[model samples]
Target: MATRTRRAPPKARTTSGPAFEVDAARLPPLGMPPAEFLRDYWQKRPLLVRNAFPGFVSPIQPEDLAGLACEEAALSRLVAHDAAHDRWMLRHGPFPEEMFPEMPDHDWTLLVQDVDKWDADVAALLAHFGFLPRWRIDDVMVSFAAPGGSVGAHVDQYDVFLLQAQGQRRWQIDASEAMGRTAPPLDFRDDVELRLLQRFNPTHDWVLGPGDMLYLPPGVPHHGVAVDACLTFSVGMRAPSAAELLGDFVDTLAADADDALRYRDPGLAPPKSPGEIDADAMERVVEALNLLRMNDPERLGDWFGRFITVYRSGGQVMPGEDARSRIEVEWDLQQGARLHRHPFSRMAWRKAKRGARLYVNGAGHALPARDAARIADNAVLDGPLYASLSEAGRDRVFELMREGHYHLDLRQDDE
Candidate 1:
């Protein structure tokens, strides 16, 4: 195993600079150095970072979020609380525009998932999360809540960073006990649509203003309520369960498995009881199943690369009716056109013996490791970098672009 090197703490900084730009060396959101945060807090404990984004202003407003909730493709929800009756109601969206005006002034919230895939400004916030693998990120979800609005107390099975974008919200968490093997079994209330905690006892409570942030590890039960109308951005991580991995892995194996392979027992002794399953029969069964086991490391790696790049949701990115030719792409690049990655498409890379395998939206391409890294890390293919690509790399990129993993932006050239 390679040893981790400890470095001096990083100096504090201001707002995350520009869209799709990252300075991995200086991460201000964590309040501590990325390495230290990863070591001491990542998936291990809950942390409250004050003024993580000092003077931060929301790029999108509540009206904008409501507008997005009206779109058919957007995954959204509205949660309303009836305080008088102590009742909670849940409704899924593409809500009509008129629904907002009809809603009660308080005790309601609108939440939109995968806002990063729909809005550039929301996606830009992802650049700040360079400390984690790109594939591990699910999406940036934005929530707009009215005064006294809440989703109820619940425990998430994945890590999350909650950043206050506007106004103020109160957060309470049960941090007296960390979640692990020794932690008590969790119980939920079956009365409501959401999986709310049966009982909640908060050990920490605080109200967050704009620019403040709260980080919670998986299985940490927490609750949040809007102190006033506010907008909050949730950066959530993806954690695939063992069953999900096994199911996908088996599918891949079956796709490439040999049909001719069969169980054989050439030399066998007669059984005293023909109906009974003897020890020898069980041994052969185990031996037969062993043929289906994954023995090659490269094959396993490739399957995992393809599996993770799809994340939880797939088929969001689709090819256009008109496909651009390689020549057209080349001409556009020469004309100062840039290539933008489809926000819904996930990318990741791994080193291979020959070079590296770049995985994008569940597709893999072999390229030089350096080139693979560049493609996986940069969402936009700029003029200089496009010029530097090898013929093979460029060809792969063109194919990917044609398949809708990326699109050409010609506004700059037109200007």
Candidate 2:
């Protein structure tokens, strides 16, 4: 499927004036300082912050969500539960307009992934969570549900901040670590997409209004039913398992390695039984594998840089940023114009004293020591900040802009 660039322009029009500000302040929504929250709750337990975003209005309407679902490159699904028949149904989307209206009125949900990639205002909300490492952040998934509608009780492996963007939803969360262990694993019907636990004994339950947020850690079973027509924005994080990380890194390493770098058997010994592998052979294999330096400082940095900076498969896209030339962009930046990172672009880095491994998209590049360190410190360079940089620093700025991760639009009339 082709990637979907948002119908909405990168710039939003403001009423009466050009001034447009959507976020209140870059503060932890839960009233705790970022340090305190990260230390106490992140990946450790659940935290509910009521009206965390005070006077917050949803950036997009329910209709907007449905419209996006009809587009190619949109990963969407329709989930329905039939109470009368005691059956659950799941369907993938690119759904036709008529299909939604025909869905059961009171027990269905429409979920669309990476809304921030499509809407600037929705993407602005991510800046609020700047307290966390930006590389670990994933896309913002938006879901709309009918009254009494839910996706079922299932546990997510990664952490999620379920922000109620519109109307209200009743959330029932199972705090018990067992994920409601009722059986070895009961056979669920074919209709469900998740291994939904049948009996969910919730320790935390609440009806969340617009702007109300719930933070759930990994492995906690959670179920949410809409109290009325509503929209929920799930700010998800990446939490790859150790095995997954190693597997991908191994694949990456092998791609660049010489085919002749194979196992050496200089001291071969015959086994007593041909079917029985000797422990000496196994030891030799382990030693050869260890030589790959899976844990070496140099290789670890490379793996971390590429793994965290890969673009989401079907997320948002920024226009014209990649097509611009460095000198042309540097000239524009010299005029004191603003450049912002595209909402859909994922950028992260690993720093060293002399330089840094700055990864944008799936590729890693070396950055000047100061420029890289400053990004690690502040993560962005706005107009004034760009002016503050030396000529070398400003040139580095142009490189990021040309790469398409950071965007600049000269079409807008002087502010």
Candidate 3:
């Protein structure tokens, strides 16, 4: 569905603290360095961090989030818990403002996704998690719940960090890892939009306050319920399914293959049983399939860069001016202004045998090896650095700007 946006961007309810520092070296709350955190906890186990963002004030408020839910372009949902029936139900959003006041004060929750794309402060929270690679990130989802509301006991296929922003929420995660996507033993209620577990057993449980956070790896069953009216933010990471990766390879990897070659049986053997496909025919088919295999590093790297960097969100936007002529690009480059990549655009790259493949929003570009490293490492390129680019490299910068992926980093006093 398209986002029903207005003439001006919606201001966040509140902004983050002016001087709340985010250090890339020591990730606070976890009390662990990036290297240690990656080695011990990441993808291996869950980590509970108390006061992850001390004195943290959410940029958007519960009410503002509710307003965004009513926008057709923004993706939102309402989940209501029916404790009497021990079940949960969901309603798709594009909700009306009037529908909220009459809602039951308890047992309900409103969730809005991709908040980072719209709010700058929410986007800043992602920078703190820079310990992980950029391309793997999905989006930020913010939820506001009334007293006793819950999404039920369930496990997610992607990794997520649940950050408590307001009030309190008691969370519980299963100890035995009994719940899984492929294997099922848990009880589920029918006629519900959520795939919620009927019962949950926990080896770990905690009541998180403001700034507290819990990180769970993929396939960990967990449940959370509001102690009172509260808010939570989820930073989810993307992981492609096996089918998706294979589909990319099959559909994309050998698209440039020579179509002129046809299957031939030079060594024809007469078989007594005509029903069976002979070994020679099978060999030819297998050989052809092998030829299309993504075994080569450069070929695979090119495909992977494009595959992972594809943006999948309803609110992605091009920020800069469209139809920018070369003169305009040249003027912008020479103006000595800092350039920034838009938050909605996804970018990634891999070092090829000679140069590197630069991927942005699902498209790939080949550039010199030296420049490729600079592109991968540098998210913000200063004016002097932009001017220093060769003719081809400069043209690439212009293309990104024209596409609205790159532009002047002019942080407005207000969003």
Best candidate according to TM-score: 1
Clashes of 2: 0
Worst 10 residues of 3 by lDDT: 4-13
Better candidate number, 1 or 3, judged by TM-score: 1
Candidate 2: regions farther than 4 A off:
1-28, 178-191, 269-276, 315-328, 373-381, 389-400, 411-415
State the lDDT of candidate 1 residue by residue for 280-333, as single tens digits.
Answer: 888998988889899888888989999999868723888865467778777887
> For candidate 2, lDDT tens digit of each residue in 234-319?
99997778887878888878887777667787888776898877888888888777666566676678777788776344554444
Error of model 3, residue 174, in angstroms:
1.5
| TM-score to native of every candidate shown | 0.89, 0.83, 0.84
Candidate 2: residue pairs that collide: none
lDDT of each: 0.82, 0.72, 0.74
CA shift of 334, model 3, Å: 5.9
lDDT of 3 by residue, 344-364 (tens): 777777778866778877888
Write down the worst ten-residue block by lDDT for model 1.
12-21
lDDT of 3 at 118: 73
Which candidate would rank higher by lDDT, 1 or 2? 1
